[model samples]
Target: MSEREMETTDDDRGMDQLHVAGVTLTGVARGGVETCLMAKELGVMFDIGMCPPGAQRYGTVLASHAHADHLGGVHYLASLRSMFGQKPLKLHVPVEAAEPLQRIFAAWSELEGYQVPVEIFGHAPGATVTIRRDVQATCFRTVHRVPSLAWVVERVSRRLKPEFQGREGAELKRLRQAGVEITDEHRAPELCVTGDTQIEFLLSDESAMARRARVLVHEVTSWEAGDAGAIARTRRWGHTHIDELIAAAERFEGEALVLVHRSMRHSRKAAEAVVARMPPSLREKVHLLGN
Candidate 1:
C-alpha cells in the first residue's frame, strides 16, 4: 500500500484528501470543531460534521457518536437530499443516540411542516449492517466521553478454491454443473474509521478487525506530551495522545495508520515533527490526515 497527498480544489469544499490502500478519503477532522470523512468508493460517510458540501451524494452515513462536531449536520444532510429529490438517507448511529436524534428530527418536521426523510437505525456493539451484496459494516464499541463506536467496512468476494485453482474454465463449469462448490468466500476488511476514541479502543479485544483493516483512521487529539500528567489529562477528556499511539503503534497491523482529529492547540507542522521522531517502522506506516 502507498500513501499520496491529493490536491484539494475548490470543488472539494475545503476537505482534505488522501489516497491509500486502494481508496480515497476526503474530509476534515479538527478536535472540538468538526469531523467528517467520506470513502467515495464505499458509498458511506462517517460522521456528518456540519454536512460539508458534497455530503448528500452518499446515501448512507455511519455515525460514531452524538457529539455535535461529529453529528451536528445530520439534519442538514437529510434536508438537502430531500430538497434535491434524492432517496431518503440511511443513518446508522449508536443505540443510545438513536432516540434523541429521532426526536430532534421530529421537532424539525414540526417546524418545517413536513416529515424529515431520513431513516435512522440503532446499532449496539457487534452489530453488522449490509451496505451492499458485496460490502458490509461491522460496529464495535470505542472509549469516548459519549457513546461512541467504530465502523469496519469489509468487502466479500468468492475465489476458486485451492484444489480448483489449476482447473480449466470448462472443467470449473463442469464442477459447478455437478453441484460442487468450487469457490470459497473471502471477507477482507478494507477500512476502519474511529470517529473519536481513547487509546483503550486500540488495546481492547474488540479491535481485532480494526487492527487488521487495510486503512485504519484513528483519532489523536493531543500531540505533545507536555508533562507527566499530560497523557492522563488527555485520557480524562476521552481522547488519545500521540505518545499513547506511538507506544501501541506496533499493535496495529494495517497498511496505513492515519491519525486525525487534531486539536487547534497543535499546528500541523508540530504534529509532523512528532510523527517524524517516531520509530522508522511505525513512522513509515503513519500518516496525518487533513491539511
Candidate 2:
C-alpha cells in the first residue's frame, strides 16, 4: 500500500462504517418541482402535493410554503385518516400559512366529524422543533414569490470514544464528579431541503443553508441564464441560482448536494449541460435530481 493509504486514521476508516441511513426523500422536484418526503421511521410526511407512490400511508404532512405544488396534497393526507381509520394527521405549517390553513382544517374537521390537528412548529425562521428524539427539524427564512421556508433535519446519537471505550464505570463516576460536556452528537447532518430561495441565500455564510447538513436539496431553476435579469429576479422574488449553490457547497464541504426544482424553461438536456459546467468541488458533491 502507498504511504497515503497507510496514514489514514481509524476515525477516517470508521467513518465509512458509520450507520447513516435515514429518511426517504422522493417526488422532490420530480414533477412540478414539488418536494415531498417521507420521514420513514418518524411516521410523517414533509410537503405532499406531488405525492410519491406508497406515501399515502404516512399520517402527517408539513407545508414548507404556500406553493400549490408543495401544499396541494394536504387534502389527500387528511382524507387518509378517515379512509384508513388511522389517527388524524399532523400538518405543520409556517405561522403565516397556519391560520388560513387552520380555517380550512376547521371546515375539513367538521366534514370529517373528527379534528385533524394543525401543528404550527418551527414556522419562524431559526426556530427549532423536535419531531421526535432521533429527529429534529428547523426552518430558515427564504425568498420566494410567497413567504417560504428551508429546512434541516438533524440526526443525533451517542457513543463512547475509542479512548474511553471501556471506561463506562469509572468514567461515569468521574463524569458525575466533574461537569464535563457529556452529550450526544450529530451523527451527520441528515437532510437540508431548500424550498425556494434567491442566489444570495445560498451564498450567504450566515444562512441556515451553510455547513450544517449531510444532504442538501436546492432548486436549480433557470440554470442556463448568464445571470442577467435572472439574478435580479432571484433577489426580487427570493430564489437561488445554481452558481450560488456551487459556492455554498464548496464553502462548507456538503457531503451531498441535490439540485432540484428545475424550471420548465430548462429541459433535461439543458439542465445536464448547465450542470456539466460545475467546478470539480461542486461536481464532486453536487447532484441534479428530477431533471
Cα lDDT of model 1 by residue, 95-152, tens digit? 9999999999999999999998999999999999998888899999999999999999
**How far is 286's C-alpha from truth in model 1 (Å)?**
0.9
Report the number of the highest-TM-score candidate.
Answer: 1
Q: Model 1, stretches more than 4 Å misplaced?
A: 1-13
lDDT of 2 by residue, 72-162 (tens): 7676666654465555566767778888877777888899787765454437777776666777777777667777777777776776545
Runs of candidate 2 exceeding 4 Å displacement: 1-24, 30-33, 39-44, 110-122, 161-163, 168-187
In every candidate, how many clashes are there? 0, 7
The candidate scoring highest on lDDT is: 1
Write out the backbone clash pairs for model 2: 143-238, 197-239, 197-240, 198-238, 198-239, 198-240, 199-240
User: What is the alpha-carbon lDDT for the whole of candidate 2?
Assistant: 0.63
